[model samples]
Each structure stands twice: as structure tokens, then as C-alpha cells.
Target: MGVNTLYFGVDFGTTNSSVAVYDGHRAWALPLDPENDLPTSLPSLLYISRENEKIVGRAAADAFIARNVDREVKTKQVDLGVSVEAYVGAEPEKSEVFNPALVDPEVRHAVRARATIEVNAPGRLFQSLKSLLRQPAFKSTEVFGTPYQLEELVSYILSPIKKAVDGCAGHAVETVVFGRPVRFSDCDDENRIAEDRLRTAAKLAGFKNVAFFLEPVGACVEYAVSVEEKQCLMVVDIGGGTCDVCIMEFQGGSGPEQRLAESRILSVAGTPVAGDALDREIIRNRIFPLLGSKARYGPSNLPMPQYIYNQILDWQNIYKFNNEEMINWLLAAEAFSNCPEGLRALRCLIQKNYGYLVAREVEAAKKRLSEVESTHITVQRDDIQIDDILVREEFSHIIEYTLGEMRECILEAEQNAGIRPSDINLVLTTGGTCLVPAIRAMLEERYGAGKLRSRDSFTSVATGLAVVARYV
Candidate 1:
């Protein structure tokens, strides 16, 4: 009997990650947990507490809020070696720098504290998720965390889908067609390094063979699968992390019978300043003010335990928050003082009371801004109140700074491919962030609206990846 062929596609996003599988004719997203019908897309976060030697996910995100730690931290911050600080609401009257070694002690204490807390309990959190991923519905033995190598996180995110497919097929799946951005980081060497890292991660994650498809190109393939006839179409993919554009010539009939005449990834643009960056900017620019004196300490002058900053950095991931818990923690900020010593105490208090709320406001704003023209983001305290509606303009301004580079990238790609903008046949868009209006407008202005095309803004790459897996 011929072995059943099952293909899995993974979109390991920066903010959220997901997996999908294709069984010859149809593509379906795989559930990470049984409760949700949608494919599994978890925040790319993992909380590790040495005291209990424990790790947690969505629930630990909640614990982060109750403790009043900042939750706007990004994976790139670790890459940049930026250190974050935490502020407390008490006073020591003198600046005292605690030893870095104290991080272990502080984390241990925090973990122990969480274990006792009912809502923020790590054990329960861990068990809940463990049960969810291991449910018979997915037929998976393990759910992995973000990979240790920053580059490998994407591949690790993809592994579960591969596992599910292999299990369903009852055989090892050897090859995959993956997605790539047309342009990555400014530094070609860095961008190349990132790609190499991803390739390595895929191999380590259990794929024996792999091929890369530009994200926009993949969207065209999926779109072409449904449409017919000769036409020049453009595909735009706005995703969580990157925005991509491709133009292609589509020919032939509907169903599985279609032909791609010519294709080029016009621009693969990303703002290191994506949704996560915007969230952090909101925390740093808006939400932090609500912490009053405790949040005022400058990174340079503040004298406090290094662990406090470590905690703040840890709390920055929005995936760490648990609803109003983050807001409540910030409400306690009135008790904090502005002096370095006072800030240390306030930081400690926040770490104990409201870390996760700060994380959530930032996260919510990011999600809101994507679909809505404006969003009201606020953090309330007796003495400190932050209430502001972040409008589309503000987001557009931030986005433009990055999109400018993308435009330049398109010019370069055009130059490299030796094709004029007019010569482009179709434009393809993909990625989650591509849904942002400002981004779409910018592409339309440059490439013309008639040339552009897009798949479901979020899942096209994974869908194309499934197609690639089938061919491999």
C-alpha cells in the first residue's frame, strides 16, 4: 500500500505562532488545544522559574500581570542586549545597586510566590496547557517551547505540525516547501545568517528536505489554485513580523490546473518595529507614565537590583498578561516613589501587584490598531492616569518610518531584477501585519491597486507551504 501523504505548514510568527496540515486535496489548521476549533497559535512566550524549576505559558502570562511587571518585552531585545529595569514604591533614601547574582534569588522568590497564588499558580497553568496540547484530538506527544536559538524559534514552532502529519501518515515526512521574505534585515550578512539559522532549525525540527518560497509567491499559488485565465496579479502579505509583495502572471484554468508564467518577490519589507515594537513603544511612551514615581527612574541613574530589570524585561511580553490583572497592578502604582531607592520599592510592589496589566494594554493596542482606525488605551491610578486614543495616524507615522525602507527595498529589487515597476504583472501580499491600512496604501501607491492581490492576510504562507510540502 502506498504510504498516506500528509504535509504540515507552520507560520512561526513573532507575536503568535500556528501550525497547519494538508492531506492531499485540503488544508486544515491543527489545534494546539482541544477547546479551540481554530488551529493552535500561542503567544511565542515561555516563562521559566528556577525556584520551582517550572515553566508556564498563557497562564504564566497572567502571573506576570498580577506581579505588576512590564510585559512589552520583545525577542529582539534579547538579541540587542538591552537590559530592562523594574521600579518599586518604597524608599531607602540612598541609591544602592544590588548584585547581579541576586537575579537567581529574586526569581526563586517570585516563583515561590506564584506557586502559592491561586489564580497565578504555575503548576496549574503548566498542567492545563500540557493537557491541552496532549489531548487525543491533535494526536501529538509533545508541544515544544520557543527554540533556544533565537533563529530556531520559527522552526520549533513548525515542529508540532510536522509531528501531527507524520503521525497521521504513519511515516516519516522528508521534505517541505517553506516561505521566505524577499528582504529581511538591512545587513545582507545578517539577513543571510537569519535564513541559514532557519534552515538549520527546520532540519533539527525533523524535516529532512526543504525548499523556500517567497511569502507573496506562495499566496499567488494559493490564489491561482482558485482563480483562472490569464491576468497579471499582485499579492500582498502583511504578517505579524514582515510585509511582503509579489507580482505574478497567472494563466490557465481553475481547480488544480493553473500555470504561473512569471513571478518576482518585489519587496519583502519588515520593520524591526512591528506590532511588538509598537506595544513596547506604547508601554514606554504611555503606560509607564501611569506607574507614577516608580516608572520614572532612568536606566542610567537608577540603582536597584538587576533582577528587577530582568523581571521587567520578562514581563514585557504581552503573552504574559491575564486581563485586568495588569491594570490592577498599575493601579497600585500610587504607592510608588520617584527616587531611585523609592523606585526600587515601587518596582518590587509592582512586581508583586500589576506587572501583567502593563503587558496587556500594550498587546491589546497592537491587536486593536490592526483592525480599528483607533483604539483607546489607558492605565488608571489614583494619582496617575493615562488615557489616550491611539489613532490610525500615529500608527501610520510609526509604520511609515519602516515602510520607507521597504519602498527602497522595492526599488532595489526592481533594479536587481532589471524590471520597471510598470513591467510587474501582479503584486502579492501576505503576513498578519499586511492588513494594516497604511501599509496597504503605501504598496498600492507604489505598485498600483490593480496589480495587487492577497490571500487571507494571516494564513497564506502556511497554505502555500502545504502546497510546497505536497510537491516535495
Candidate 2:
């Protein structure tokens, strides 16, 4: 079959990405990370080596683990330059007459401070680039002394998926439909900017015909295929970075295009709090205390600064603490603290870039909690050893506020659809977060356990997008 005969859908999500193909009748998700032993979806990750070599997906994680973990960082100090300041002559005194003509001025100059950086570090690993799309201030970031635009970084993730899709199709496929959230940001303009950025990245990745579809709507479309009769359906897609809710009407007869044209879509709403936020809660509530969050230093025995521990709450932001200033502060704190073991471990974590390891453990614990009543989160490497038992009840309590927000999001979608909770005939939940027991319980409490239906948690959106691509 030629490329023109097929339709493609790319779910470029904040946490994981997947590509699906449809040839008018059949739709399936292509394996991007076959060796993962999990879902076919690819983890959204990028690694840039010291030599500027870029790697993506599973290989990226493997490369980071092989290079950064359990390695002692080597640092160096190098002079950057000197800064010179010019001012009026001291003789002018308080009178300080304005310069009607040229006058002698005093000049002060000092050597710029030297910066400490890891000279033998392997590379930098990045995740959650999709979350930065809506921020106007974040245009580019430096990687190995080279500046890379946001679109360029995004393209790094998309290009490989494009190549994989082409290999599967036996020819290059440039046309694609990508799934997007209902809102990348609270502001409409910012959301548009995020879409534009994503479009630009798709083009950079060699997509010739690109289209966008709401993620929740895509999930709804996938669920609609099995509907035997007309019914009110609500789709709740809670992914890594955002929670998207859609209320719609589903009937058996209509095709994807007709569904879009008709009043099938009643309402769509989304919030930025989702899986990652819950993971952060685990790190903050369960792991942070063991990592020196409660340590005290100085003669007065004051508690450690909250900001130091805050940096590690979000694994993606933990790299910011690797700078010279933060390192110096950590060293000072470690020397004076009543308990130096945790602070020392914290320093080791930053110096060796072990944040990814901690994130992986937390995510694994979260997954286990969904299936079991209790699990243990263990983060161990060199001097760092944190083992904590996390129970389902405690996990729910840790994420109580986040769960409340998600419930509100569902209510928002229902209210916008002009219907009460009872009006919904069926509930379709997708994405990794929906597998959480607390989240499932909340949905069951609202709509009854019998009404909740779950398709493929990871690939439904991509499949739905493929269906949309075929018809629309």
C-alpha cells in the first residue's frame, strides 16, 4: 500500500508518545520502544551527550543510566572575563555638574567570577518538554554550550517517531494528526502559542500535512466505536502532565467525520495537574524527609531551608541545584547540620545526576500502589538510601488536594455540557493516571462502578486520532 492510502496519528504526550496507523478499516499502535516490556508507547525523554549527540526515548534513558548514575562528578573552575564600570570623576563631589563637555571619569574593573562545572560529566537528560510549550519566556536552552530552540528540542522527539512510522509503512508518511490538550495554558493566547510551537516542531520533523485534535475528544472517538446505541458519554483522560475531560454523545452509526460535524461534542475541559504532580507529592511527602528536608544546621539549630528540598520535588527541576552556588550551600549545610548523612546524600544526588533514578522509583511505586494496597519506595545509590513504605490510604491522603482538583475538572466538563452527573450513561477513562485506585474510586463514587469503562490505557488517544485522520 502506498503512503497516500494510510492515515497516521501521533500522540505526542507530556510523559509518553505513540504513533498509530489506520487504513480505513483497521487501527493499531506501532511499537516505538519494543524492548521496554511495558506498553508500546515511547517515554518522552531526550539526552544530549557532551559531544552534542542527541538520543531519544528508551535508548535515551539507557544512555543516561549508563553514563550518569553512581558516578562521581569532576569539577573545574575557569575564568570567564572581566567587567568594567564607568562613573563620573570623584572631584565632581556632591555638586556633580552634568557633562556639558568631556570630563575625566573613574573606571573600576574586576575579574569576572569563575564558575564551577562538571568537566567529566556524560550528558544532560531532559523530560516534560511539552509542559514548557505555553511559557513565552522559555524560548531556548543551552545544551553542551549550544543553544537549541524549543521547537528544535521538540523535533528531536518527533523525528525518530517519524522514521519509525516510515519504516513500518514501507514508505515515508508525512501526513499526520497530533493529539493536543484542551488547554496548554489557562490563557487562550498561550494555548494558541503552544499549538503553533507544536506545529512548527512537526514541520521540522518532516511532517508535510499536520493537524491537531483535542486529546479527550480523540479518546472519546476511540470509545465511541463500541457503542451499540445512543448514549451520553464522558471521557476522562488523566495523563502524565494534564487531565482532560470531554462530555459527548455517542451512537453506533456515524463515522468519525460526522461525529465531529454533529453535536456529538458537548463540552471539553482540562487542568494541568495530573500524574506528574502526584509523583511529586510522593517525592515531597514520602522521600524528602529522608533526603535532609528536616535537617537542622547552625548554632541555633534552625531547620534547613525549604527551598533546598523544593528543588528535588520535581525531578526535572533538580538539575538546577547542580550549580556552584547551590553546591556551595549544600556543602556548608552538610558541615554544620546536626545530621549530615542526608545532606551528603542530597549533594551526591545532584553531583551525580541521580534525579532520574529517584523519579523512576517514585513512578514505579505509584504504579504498584494502583495494583496493591501497599508498596515500598527505595532510592539507593552510594551514600543515598531511602526506603519508605507507602500505603494506599496514605497515598490518597498525600494527593487529596490533587484528587479534589481532578473531581472539579470532571464537574466542569459536566456543567459545561448542561447535564447532571446522572445524565451521563457511560464513563470512559483512559491514560496511566486513571489506573490509580483513588482516581478510579472517585469516578465510581460519582457514576457508579458499573458505568465506568476502560479501553487501552495508553494507546486509545492515538487510535482515536488515527480514526479521525482516516475520516477527517
Candidate 3:
């Protein structure tokens, strides 16, 4: 069995990425992480942690060791599940516990693969490789003394997924169709730059021939599968980093030519305000105050610099809080605030690189709130303890601005599509945010309850891209 298909469709997203393949008879998603038995869609997350003895992707291990590894090593257990566990003994040991020098090359590469992504927990964790593609200020970042360009970093993230694709297809896949948002971030130039970067990454990831498709349009293909009649539809994709809306016309059927010839791409619009923004909002509103972000400074008794609190909102930038200048600034603010307890809270949170941990808690809470009226935001670190209550109403209010912006984006897509809401036959919504009750209600309110529909929120794009891969 050689490469079974001509092309694969890859939806390389901000929070999670996914890949789908098309055979002559059908289209289906391929699981990118066989090691963890992840679903068809892969978390668009890449983490690098050298200090941690365990190396697993997404939910495996933290994929990193906090800088306290030297100290924590005495407590952190080697993953007994792996053969390497015997190398470190049955119990937790000292700092040099599972040195890579003594391990097999496969284990060493697994531990050291993609260290240049984002989060660095006390210096062990990193993630969110897709977001950096749009940052003009980010040219290169170094990891463990190795300098990496954004493409190389993203490519590294894609490497494993490519391997999975090859193994599943029985032959190496060289041509691919990549699903991308119509807009990346907020600007046209940035979107173009990001697409270019994605192209490079796809190439670097092992696809020799690559193509691009708008994310929602790809989802349109997914939705059209069930319908037999031609229809006009709107697709709203709420992803980790951006919200993209598209209006398209589809001729629903399995014939590749009929599928390709009839689909018309109409309005495409997007905004940077999406799930990550909501995650940040949760961090700011519910988690910050508990971390002494709102406390007054000492002598002057003035409010601490707001950036000190705001900077840690994104786990992407959490490591920035540990720089020397930021430390000095915090120290001065601590002295001026005169509140030793509050200042200490801030210092301890920053010193331990608690942002990622807190953000993770906030995220888990946010998801819980979506399903229930309220949830708990637990922050338990060395000395910083916070078990705060967060209600869905409060979360709704916190993310009101984001909701409003998403509303505006939807309307913009409608306006640009040159059709009234009534003219649209169906409103297809997907992505993690699509599950949000408030978001669902908002769509239902505007599109009429009967006109709105839902696809597999997380895997729709990849599935559709798989179908379109054959044609595009």
C-alpha cells in the first residue's frame, strides 16, 4: 500500500489542529496523536519541556518541568508507564532523575521536539504555535540554545500529524488542502502574512503541493453532505484565536464535480475576539483580583500598574512576567503598595509562573460554566490558594464585549453576502465557542430557531477539508 489518496485537508487552527483524508469512496478525519488516542482533531497545541521526565502531547504530561524541577524533582514521579521509569527507580529522586543522556534517542527526541511554541511554566511548558504566525514583532525565538523561525516551529508541531497521516494513508501524502480563516487577527496584511507562514509550515511539515480553503467554506462542504437541494448558508466558526463567518452557496451531493462547480464563496469576515479572548476575560475578571492585581501600592497608595495584572492574562505571554525588568517593576510596586500580603501574593504568583496554571483553571471553569450555572475556579499553588466561585451570568457579562464583537462580525458577513437573514437557508455554527449557550442563543435569535444548525463543533472543518481535498 502506497499513499492511498492524492491529497489531505489540514485544518491547522489556533487552539487545536486537525487533518482529514479523502479516498475515492469517502472522506474521513485521521487522528493526529496515536500515542494519546486523541480524537480525529488534534489540539492545535505544541508544548516543549525538557526538565520533565515524561513526554506526552496535549494531555499526556505537562510536556515541561517547571523551573522548580531541581526542587520538585524530589517529589515528581517518573512515569512508570514507560520503560524509562526503571532508569529513575520506583520512587521520586533528586534533580538529575531521568537524564536524557542515558535514555534512548527516541525518548530524547520525544522530550526535546518542539520547545519554541509559547507557555514556559517556570520554564517547562510551551504551546499555541499558530498565534505567533501573525506577530510581526516575532521573527525568531530560541529554545534550549537552538534558534527557530516561526515556520520551523510550526512545522515541528505539524511533524507528528504528518506521520500519522502517512501511516494511516499507507503512503506518504505530498499534496494538501489547508483550511484557514478568511482573516487571521484583524488586518489584511496580517492575514496574508499568516497564510504565507502557514503555507511555509505546511511545506515544511512535508506536503510538497499545498492549497488553501476558507475554513467556513470547508465546513459548508461538511454541511452540504446531508442535503440534496441547492441552498444558501452562513457558516460561523468560533475557534481558539479568531471568529470567522462566511456565506456560501452549495449544491449538495457526492459527485466531486457537482460539489466543486456549484459552491460559490460569498462574504467572508472575521474578528480576533474569540475563545482566547473569553479565556483572557475570565482570567482578568475572576482570577486577577484574587491574585492581588487590584490591590493598591504601598507609599503612594496608588493602584498598581494595570499591565502587571493584564500581562499574565494570556498563557501565551505568561513567561514575560518573569523578566528582570518586570520583576524590578513589581518589586517597586510591592514596596509602594505597603501591603506586604498583597505584594507577596503577586510576587509568589509571578515567581512560580502561576499564569498558565491559573489560566488552565479558568479555562476549565469557563467550560464548566457553559454547561452549568456556575463552576469553581481553583488555584492551588505553593502558597497561593484560591477557590473562587464563577457564575455563568458573570462569565456572560465578562465576555459581553467579545459577544458583541462576534455579533458585529456575523452581521458584517450577512451584509457582505448581500442577502437578508431570511434569504439564508441555514446557519451552520461550529468550534468550541459554538457550544456556548449565550453564543447559541444569539445565533438562534438572529437566524431564527429553525434556520440555525450545528455540526461537530471541533472536527467539522477537518472533515469538510477532507472531502474538498479531492477536488481542490
Clashes of each: 56, 0, 10
Please identify which of the two predictions, 1 or 2, would achieve the higher lDDT against the true structure.
2
**Top candidate when judged by lDDT against the true structure:** 2
lDDT of 3 by residue, 252-285 (tens): 6666567667788888998876888888888787
- TM-score, every prediction: 0.63, 0.88, 0.83
Candidate 1 stretches with Cα past 4 Å from truth are: 1-4, 33-37, 40-42, 49-156, 253-273, 288-350, 353-356, 370-373, 380-385, 410-427, 447-454
User: Cα RMSDs of all predictions?
Assistant: 10.7, 8.5, 12.8
lDDT of 1 by residue, 121-217 (tens): 2211121121122122322222133223433334444556567656655788777666766544545665666566666767877887767666656
Regions of candidate 2 where Cα sits further than 4 Å from its true position: 1-4, 72-117, 254-263
For model 2, where is the 10-residue window of minimal lDDT?
83-92
Arrange candidates, best TM-score first: 2, 3, 1
Model 2 Cα lDDT, one tens digit per residue, 35-149: 5655468888899998999998888999999987775657777443322111121111311442414321221122234445665768888888898899889899987689999
What is the TM-score (0 to 1) of candidate 3?
0.83
